[model samples]
Target chain A: MDTVCSINNLARCLVEGGFSPDLANLLTLLGGVVLVATIPLVTVIFLIWIERKVAARVQDRLGPNRVGPVGLLQTVADALKMLTKEDITPTGADKFIYNLAPVIAFATVILMWAVVPFTPLHIGADVGIGVLYFMAVASIGTVKIMVAGWSSNNKYALLGAFRTIAQLLSYEVPLVLSLLIPVMLAGTMSLQGITEAQGGMWYLFIAPVAAFLFYVANLAETGRAPFDLLEAESEIIAGYNIEYSGFKWGMFMASEFLHAFTAALFFAIIFMGGWWGPFVQEVPLLGALYLVGKTAIVYVFGLVLRATVPRVRIDQLMALNWKFLVPLAIANVLVIAFLIQVLKALGLMPVPGADIIAHLPMTVVMLLGNLVIIAVAMQVLRNQGREEKMAQEARMAARQQRVVKEVRTPAGAPVGD
Target chain B: MLEFNASTVAFVVMTLFILGGALGVVTTRNLIHATLYLILSLFGVAGYFVLLSAPFLAAVQVLVYIGAIAILIVFAVMLTRSMTRMSEILNGQWLLSAIVGAGLFLLLVIGVILPTWGNGGLLDATVSAPSQVVIDTVDLGKALVDRNGFVLPFEVASLLLTAAMIGAIVIARDDTE
Candidate 1:
């Protein structure tokens, strides 16, 4: 009876009720796919509304107050407007690819949900390589952006796509490397397996540096503020989707909102003991609630950061990813791997026990190691910042001296001026 | 007669994707369209991996080929001004290349595929394959890192990738001085 909530169990029931086996299986699979797809799509409307309200509050203004109570139905109204809006196809755009990009962009993010574990038993597929599946599907998103940019036949769109590729590809290194820590700790790539392993202790406590790296890289992955040079409106004129209009453009925006929220949910699932709370084991519905609640908290935190931080320069963005996060992520993985091996050799690893509290000693050791890593990373960043600042000052002084000399000279300009 | 097994249907769909996408890739005049078709073809290959029950390999195929390699190709396509609009996609050597490509195709079908799947061969009807053994992700992870497994090869691969990355950066860097 407790297993009735599972898709497999429902399939069995359908078979017993005299449906053909093939039909039953197909129906069950389709049902699961529909459920997984609907989750992100349905939530995206609310996500946009919440984001606007949050941004408005951050900027000291009343957001959408006309649609419904507290402007809850604003997204609904916006959707209607989007549907009725005239779809524009730019004059030199590749007809097929220009139309395909939005669908692919939206579909790829939804594909990621196929592996996300909403509860202990309510996952879509529970594929063995769930983490890699997420990364792979997310990578297809880069292709979608490229197609959008190229098909638009606009220079700004192409530039935006170039930035998207560089940023997404560069950040993927740290994202995948940091992801390795959780996979190593759990000894499984399955998202469900990772979450279940966290039954004892959250990976966030054990690998805080890895978690931070994952968060930063994924923030860039979503092209949010401080890492959002891809769609920096002042610079690239809304990036790859500049020429899109109507529902096609809406699809791109919805995918972005969905991707941001999905990153938060993934962070919760990987590092924050997703769907793990009191009585969740007995009541699976409660697990779903806990997962959503934790995801919302993380999502709100991301929103606040987006509202507060200014966008980074393109060069700075690339340097921050390639030079800083990549090395730090690699070093963090190596140290954590070594620490795990050492702990196992010393017979200090916590024995598998039913009580979640039994894993305290192991958690503490990993937490202390993570603290050391974070401290070292901070020291490195501080030194790098100081050096950069000093160099900038020196350059400015030299330029000022050159200006003074040029002004003092009778000639208006020097040879190299 | 139509056979309606799940795997059979999946195989047909994936085959259509692979062939259609391959056709699209070669026939398209636009470089960007060709790249998009290339992605479709790579995706079809990934789908084939999934059908073969190699989910990890499928993910890697998508991640590397479509995600990284295909995108890099598109990036290169967009950078060059004259390459994007190549009206003459084929050159004077088209006939010779076509002949060679057809010969290679025939060689692959005759020498590699046919003998392996012929009657009483490795993939014949009499040869009942062994029962499926579900290999967990943990085993895959261990095999990559274990001393007797693929640790050395994996490390070497990583080293090679790092070297290639460094080489690429050095080649791409513009030193005006």
Candidate 2:
């Protein structure tokens, strides 16, 4: 009974008033991309300010109050200073990598924004393998770090480059493993799908240890304390960045902080249940805001920790990775895998131990296993302290006997007989 | 008159890059500079993969070529620092050899660029087909495992890489005994 509507009518429905559907999609995509890229830069500046204040307050200082009305514009002033400064390259340096290294390091982080989904409508590239794509891009920055260090041809730079490699290798496994826990629960890699999976229950409740591991591993990955051996300021004198000056040095500092923020953002996305709060779906676009807010909270937490803690030694860092975190990660992965398998074996479809209680043992095993490990490690520490005390007393007794004999006999000190 | 589109633009750009890189590699005195130019050239080709609507391949190009191969080249240059510090020009009758090489290179460039001059019928035929097709990574992995497009080659390549890796490790061993 209805006549056929015109093609323009259908097109108008799709266009929603502005441009043709195809062109409109492209425009919206470009706009979303601009917003995504701009968000990190803006967040980095604001975070630096927050960090400055948080750091000052933690150490009982007044903080940055010189720039604008309680130092609100301090980062802006810093940015302007960096922008106006001279870019220097050493004479013997490889000019190409020397110039390109900072840009590549910065751009690697920015390009990763393409894979991060902001909202349902506002996504960068909705590729099939977005999560892996992000990991790949993030890892490329390590290459840039190495190149910058080696190309500088300074011994400090070479040492820093080697430390950078070791750090990346150590932390990458645990970080990726902690991330896999959430992905296992969510059952998908798509950011949208992962968020949707968190609607009923966030993975944080089921796996708090994974969240802790993620934070620690991310700090290490970004070369921040207590894992900043590559940038061990006292020992190596600014590490890989010793040869860099002015804007180039500024770029490394900026990249370091920005990468930390980006990892914090990812940690918030996966573990903290991005942008979802109690009854937040009532507001249409509040999810994106909530996500940003949660991520910023995590970023602030990282900055606070960085300011509060002193950097750990390189040996301690390597020991923590190889001895502790790696074992924990392996256990977590096996637990997750076994739980999924047991759940599938039983009639229970999604929830592993919903009805039968068969998978309860596995879940209990994971949590209790980690707890037991922590207890045993503490006991081992106490025992080692006791042993060291005894050893110290024995050494002191031997030294005293030698001194007494020498005092009595004057020259030969043969008082043992 | 040459009609230009995205594909044409990308092809011209990549061709320029490949030729320029080969020239630089051959002519540059500094080994490190040659490696840098090689990376620049690879990146230009990767950009063409993007223009061809194969962003995945473009990404792989940069990751494998610049990230891996170019890095290896630069590392070798650093490791052999003593050997790379010679004069820019080679001693003993280098200019004569260079001139002859340049003449031959010019002939090849002219032969390709001005195809109307003597490329026969190759210039007239429009290349309607894409030069390369992008297979998705998951699909590529499946194909490599499932014996359709890539299984044999994949196994062969993996074996080759394993052999090379082992050889290098063995050769670099400390030989304490």
Query: TM-score: which candidate is best?
Result: 1
Give the alpha carbon lDDT tens digit for every residue of B7-73 in model 1: 8888898888889989998787878778878888888899999988888889999999998999888
In order, candidate lDDTs are 0.88, 0.73
Q: What is the TM-score of chain B alone in each candidate?
A: 0.83, 0.65
TM-score of each model, in listed order: 0.93, 0.73
Residue A75, candidate 2: alpha-carbon lDDT? 88
Using DockQ as the measure, which candidate wins? 1
Candidate 1 wrongly placed segments (more than 4 Å): A1-9, A352-354, A399-417, B1-3, B122-137, B170-177
Candidate 1: clashing pairs of residues? none
DockQ of each candidate's interface versus the true one?
A: 0.89, 0.19
What tens digits encode model 1's per-residue C-alpha lDDT throughout A299-393?
A: 99999999999999989898898889999998999999999998999777766433566777788888888888889988999998999999999
Tens-digit lDDT track of model 2 for A1-417: 344434324444446664777666555656667877887778777767887898898889989999998998998999889888887777788787788888888888888777665654446677654555566576667777777886797888878877776787678778777877777776666666676666655566557678878889889988877788888878887778788887788778778888888888777777766766755667636777877888888888887788778888888889889878888787777766676676567644335213225434444544564465557656866896799899999999999999999777866655556
Error of 1 at A11 (Å): 2.4
Per-candidate TM-score, chain A: 0.94, 0.83
Give the alpha carbon lDDT tens digit for every residue of B68-90 in model 2: 67766666766675655656564
- True contact recovery of candidate 2: 0.11
